[model samples]
Target: MPKAQETILEIDRSALTHNYNYLKSKLQSKTKFLAVVKAFAYGNDAEKIAKHLQWLNVDYFAVAYTSEGVALREAGITKPILVLHPQIVNFKTIIKHCLEPSLYNTNVLNAFITVANEEAQTNYPVHIKFNTGLNRLGFWESDVDYIINKLKATSSIVITSIFSHLAASEDANEADFTVNQIKSFKVIATEFLSKLDYKPLLHLCNTSGVINYPEAHLDMVRCGIGLYGFGNSANEDKYLKPIASLKSIISQIHKIEPNETVGYNRAYVAKTYEKTATIPIGHADGIGRHLGNEKGYVIINGQKASIIGNVCMDMIMVNITTINCKEGDEVIIFDGNNKATDLATSLNTISYEIITSISQRVKRSFIE
Candidate 1:
């Protein structure tokens, strides 16, 4: 709420806690919770988010890469970290940091085994990902025997969990597909446990999956966007508090005549006398060019101000003619009232794209 800062991303810790508790309320007491803090916690500062979740006693933390896990460890994150897409070269670092890698394929499984053995690690914990239906990652269900054979061939890494991703748990039309995917995962998990002589945690729910498929909440659940206050559905979004609010201030105001044009390529031509407000945020700041030329709008004086002209690398122009706003007036790009989901929908995208696309250069202010 600083008056001078041109652009700032405000992170509400209370909202995050509220979201966590709300999501937790939906789960049984014994089901573990894994907070996905990958992509810098969806560009909202993963270190801070993870630290808060750690204090809340979240059962686990997951990231998209080993480097993300290393960053968390360096930041004093002591809880077990799961690297979702760990690379073979980073296996040593993963072991050094005591991070668990999701071995989705035979090559990665074998490569991680080599590293764990070389490091003299015994019974190192690793998670197995099954290709239930996503087909993006994970070993095939048909390859379950091969997976078990590989695991039995080595005691260097132990199976800690078997998980997979849900592609469309949020879509009501895909209910049948989601159910089938869950069924396939259950069969694979049961076979794996029967063969391994040990039971690893089973999980197959992301945010949407957590909401739509409670029965599939085997032993744990992974939540990413839901933790940040987006449910991917209007009804669910009504119950979640968005944690991040992207705000900025009008740096300058201009008066233009009917003949005048604005921005690169003269994207905007005034139809009449118009007042414009230049905000110090643009494509470089993650408000992409796709959001320009009246495609996106900002809230000024609690009124909508359409973004006019093309978005520049570090600035954007909004038609503030009717808002009666001056330089330094606060402008909210997206927040609870003007939801990021709505903004992304206007751009033919999703809330995740809009929220995570916020650039790191923008200052993040945490509110507790």
Candidate 2:
């Protein structure tokens, strides 16, 4: 590996391909696979991941916005792209790039209808997102008729897919709640499709739903975290490989005497003489300040090293006395052995926060 000048996020494309194939094998042969590559492919590199997935013949790609979809398109990705949370203001650009938008509100639906008609489009593909239980985005069940009516009024707008999100698909204890959500989505979707005289592709299973509720897998599945080797369950984790690894080199090492304080506000007061290795990464680089004050740790030489004090804007101090490490040694922030989920648990957050929180400032390196 090249010498680490700064914190680097290493992306494993082979592991990503493995995860994609594993998830694809779990679904029925007829079921299509939609790879979600939003949030810079969850803080890795979207264009890189999308290119690899394209090589794997992924059925579709989904992003949170039109800009993300455009990025993939510009990267020569010709596969169908779905913008999950598109805004009306970008409807023109979305259409220009042949990107499909998930119409979750009446205003958005109307705006798309106007644009489609003005553009003289016929049978333009779009997804309708229903609010199952997430309550974040998506049209409510009561809005189904309005959506169907609007679509019926315009031949330009075509319903390509209908989907919903599961709020707690990974929890076994939330099985009943998830079941209820699936049932509700099915009922609303069935009623709307019956009125339309045609059926669009139906998909509700995310990574968690694909693992926990096979029955909920409808016409397709959208796998995001699963493609990145996080299944939200121990069983799934065993079968997956993390597609990203974060590593940083120790910039310098200092031997501190007993009673000496470390970092800002004297957050870490040494009780005994110890060696500290300062790494070139910090909250500004998405490590977060909460990771300081001994709240989180990184792995060095296969052993845990705790953060000694407040995480600076571009540096962190790790107690490395026991590790026998020196300056320029590589430290593992999160990887296959010590997962980011472990750090998230320590900081009382989820792996998504830990992964997505990684800022663009951190350099990204792709390993094929």
Candidate 3:
């Protein structure tokens, strides 16, 4: 609770526990939980977060790439990691780390089958992704038979789960679209499962899907942002607790006369006598340049101070003329109270973008 001597991100383990529990409460008792820990656990210390989640007994873990899965393995994470987007080149490495890859297309599917055969892997677990509606990365509905035929030709790998992504589960207006996507996945699952002798797990729900569509919580649920205290909506946000807070210290205070400019390109010219404070965080630190010129503000001693000018790579000046604060005072970028979603909303973005945008250079302190 002390004033930050330098820029630091505090990760609260208890909040994470609360979020996990809350999200779990929405699912059936038999449903499994998969924690997505890619992007450095959404840029909040992946090793620590995964360790804690593992201790909490999550059923599985997911990452965006093969290298991320490898990093988790190197960090001593033993839970099954589903690489959402595994490249062909990393298939061998993925087998080496015992990480599961989501085979979404013919190219990746065939390449992985070959790699698995080369590695002499028998019954190695993998997941198949179907394009319910996402249109991003997934196999079409008509590809079920093709996929089954491909699997029949290979004994090196086995389908451990069948899944798809929901494109608009968080938007109420997209309810019909989300429902149809679920229906499509069900049809695909029926055809896909009927051809096999065994039943691989069927899952589609992400964080918002877990909350909004309980019927779609098939066999397991995957949660990323919700586990970090964002439910993708205000109504649900209150039920969760944000686990990370970004804080910095005021480097110096400035008293400027009228017409005095702040930062580069003279983007902010003082129209009246103003006081500003320089902060040691900027675009390079994932603050982004768009949050400059009053678009973004930091909390100082419980008062909001608008950013003065262009966001520098290493620093940002904020107008603290009305704030009765001095040098070395605490500056809050985003905290439990000043949610990252709020900052993101100001710039027409989402909470996930804002939170994950935090740079790795910042010191991370975790509350165990």
What TM-score does model 1 achieve against the real structure?
A: 0.98
**Poorly placed runs, candidate 3 (over 4 Å):** none
TM-score, candidate number 2? 0.97
Model 3 root mean square deviation, Cα atoms: 0.7
TM-score of each: 0.98, 0.97, 0.99
In order of lDDT, best first, we have 3, 1, 2
Every model: Cα RMSD to truth: 1.0, 1.4, 0.7
Error of 1 at 300 (Å): 0.3
lDDT value, residue 77 of candidate 2: 96
- Model 3 compared with the native: what TM-score? 0.99
lDDT: which candidate is best? Answer: 3
Superposed Cα deviation of residue 167, candidate 1 (Å): 0.9
Q: Give the clash count for each candidate.
A: 0, 0, 0
- Residue 364 of candidate 2: its Cα lDDT? 90
- lDDT against the true structure, per candidate, is 0.92, 0.91, 0.94
Better of 1 and 3 by TM-score: 3
lDDT of 1 by residue, 1-368 (tens): 45436699999999999999999999999999999999999989999999999999999999999999999999999999999999999999999999999998989998999999899999999999989888899899788899888878888989899999998999999999999999999988888788878789999999999898899887999999999999989999999999998999999999999979999999999999999999999998999998899999999988999999999999999998888878888999998788999898898899888988999999999987
